[model samples]
Target: MDMVISNLQQQRAVTEQLRREAAIKRMLVSQAVADIVKFINEHEQDDCLLHGFTSQRINPFREKSSCTLI
Candidate 1:
């Protein structure tokens, strides 16, 4: 009876430890995804700013046009 009780306690402890490790892994994964999204947003904002600054000097391509296209 004492041996059975000891085995049950060990199993319970192991299960709890696994659950805590899984929770920590999930939190790390979520944080990594959030960081990636933030980096992408910052890169997009930089691209938009660059395009805005260069747009005035850029020329439009036209195959055929009666009037000047800008």
Candidate 2:
């Protein structure tokens, strides 16, 4: 039927749009992660600690080894 065909076309369009948007978002997140890693690596030092996706200059514990207690 014509109506069924049209509905399928609309659904396909929506699916394609969602895929494009997801790809764009994925690229943006990848770029952000790369930037964060570059920054951390550049500024990394004896006292620097990377916690998850972020970096901190000061150790969170009294002993440096305690930071790796995770």
Candidate 3:
């Protein structure tokens, strides 16, 4: 009976340890996701600023008109 109780206690301790590790991992993942979101927002703003330098017009292929003043 004593051996059985000892085994049960050890199993309980191991289970508690695993639970704590899992909680810590979950917390770290949550923090990482938040950081990624912040970084993506900043990157998107940077791209918006860069878009101003890009082309803003598309020329038509056929365009020839002239006015003569005689």
Candidate 4:
């Protein structure tokens, strides 16, 4: 009877440890996803700036003339 009780207690401890580890892993994954989304947003804004797509109150759909007459 004592041996059976001891075995049950050990199993419960192991189960609790596994549950804690799973919770930590879930938190880490959530943090990593947030970081990745922030990085992508920043990268997109930088790309737009690099390509002259600014929001400084300028025309964004204007056409340029490339012909000259002498």
lDDT (10s digit) by residue, model 4, range 19-53: 99888734587899999999988897566556775
The predicted structure with the larger lDDT, 2 or 4, is 4
- Candidate lDDT values, in order: 0.75, 0.71, 0.74, 0.79
In angstroms, how far off is 57's CA in candidate 1? Answer: 57
lDDT of 3 by residue, 1-70 (tens): 9999999999999999999988873458789999999998889855635454334343333355689899
What's model 3's lDDT at 41? 80
TM value for model 4: 0.36
| Clashes (N, CA, C under 3 Å) per candidate | 0, 0, 0, 0
State model 3's lDDT. Answer: 0.74
Best by lDDT: 4
Which of candidates 2 and 3 reaches a greater lDDT? Answer: 3
Candidate 1 lDDT over residue span 5-39, tens digit each: 99999999999999998887345878999999999
Clashing residue pairs in candidate 2 (N, C-alpha, C atoms within 3 angstroms): none
lDDT sort, best first: 4, 1, 3, 2
How well is each residue in 1-70 modelled by candidate 2, as lDDT tens digits? 9999999999999999999988873458789999999987877763234433233434354445435454
Off-target runs (Cα >4 Å) in candidate 3 are 26-70
Q: Write down the lDDT that model 4 would get.
A: 0.79
